[model samples]
Target: MGRELVIGDIHGSYKAVKQILERAAVTATDRLIFLGDYVDGWGQSPEVIDYLLQLKSQFDCVFIRGNHDDLLLRWLKTGEYTEEWFNHGGRLTMEHYERLPADKRQLHILFLESLQDYYLDDDNRLFVHAGFTSLNGVKHEFFTRMFFWDRTLWETALCLDKSIGHNDPLYPKRFTHYKEIFIGHTPVTRIGETVPVQKANIWNVDTGAAFKGPLTIMDTGTKEYWQSDPVHELYPDEKGRN
Candidate 1:
């Protein structure tokens, strides 16, 4: 099988991202898939987006759209509602760009809008930002929304229900086709939080780095996991730093 390393959400913590990649020893022969949320949360949205775009040009990078990314895209498109966007770590995103000049900000906005929703490799591995859809009964709309909004999948993972939250409105049909499904969006305090469950080939790599948890990376084929220190230190006085 090919070398495939699927990564979890990166909320603009460049340090965490670098550590995970270095630990995984990613190479040209290996496929690196990011589950999305590449921006927001932390203060490096501009840097993170620029870095990912560059990596896409040089390496095999697959980026799926996360809810924050989609909201950021919308904010850029029409400058519409900003509550939900900023409330969920969008403040850092704005702060990241507020330091940039107009031209650079426009360039970054263009880059953000260009990201795709999902990527499927020839291998039986699927990379999605959120959870998967239900088998045979749900519509594409449901799947699309869940891709950016589902959280039950993470709970199931924590509960060790490997079925990948089959009860979720978004659990996909027939996980048998893929050897594993790489997902992000849920932030667990432990890497082993996802060790259980059947029916869904899920390998959740979101360790809640932005939430004082380690950033996560895992090899889809080998299921090897790696973690990096949270970019910023979390203390009792700074409970909401991220």
Candidate 2:
């Protein structure tokens, strides 16, 4: 089997995403699992989605839903924008879509609608855009929103003792169901790191592509990783998410 590669949020940093993919030497045979937040930050949200759609045609790809993506979908369906969404880089995404042809816009909307809340491989490696609230397997219908917004699961993981065995009650209940959990949405830059970070069994790969950090991608088995240059460097003229 090809390598199983898990990627963090892109947040419309198409240049960063492209650089990381090249650095990882991604092949058609590799399985790519993208943790969401694909849009709403940089100037290339539409281009990022376009590239992703092309990638799906060549690789085994799994796309996760994220809070920002949800906001985009909500606006696409209702033609309404919440203040929180517009203020947080959503305007850039809207501008990109508005410039596209009607058919192309619909295609991107469908792509966002088709994103999965989470993915679990046969090896018990779980991939989610954001942390899930329940220790149980993903409840897509009931906790879909949480899958894109929750952070407590990661905070709990960071506090728990990793040496504890799964059977131990002292072990984090949130991690009991999976061998490893890969996630994005909570950028590692918040902890002053610009690279993928591991806390217990959870791997946080988001290096804040929406802000001024790199984009990260990692091999699920070998724990090897690759990253783009700081996103700000890629688009020197843009203000990004400030």
Cα-based lDDT at residue 159, candidate 1 = 54
Total clashing residue pairs per candidate?
A: 11, 0
Write one digit per residue (lDDT tens) for candidate 2, span 43-133: 9999999999999998999999999999998998889999999989998788888888989989988999999989999999989888877
Question: What TM-score would each prediction reach against the true structure?
Answer: 0.80, 0.96
- What candidate 1 gets wrong by more than 4 Å, as runs, is 137-143, 154-177, 190-200, 234-242
Lowest-sum lDDT 10-residue window in model 2: 134-143
Worst 10 residues of 1 by lDDT: 190-199
Residue range 105-142, candidate 1, lDDT tens digits: 78877777777666777875667777755643123435
List runs of model 2 lying over 4 Å from the truth.
162-165
lDDT of residue 63 for candidate 1: 76
TM-score of 1: 0.80
**Alpha carbon lDDT of residue 147, candidate 2?**
89
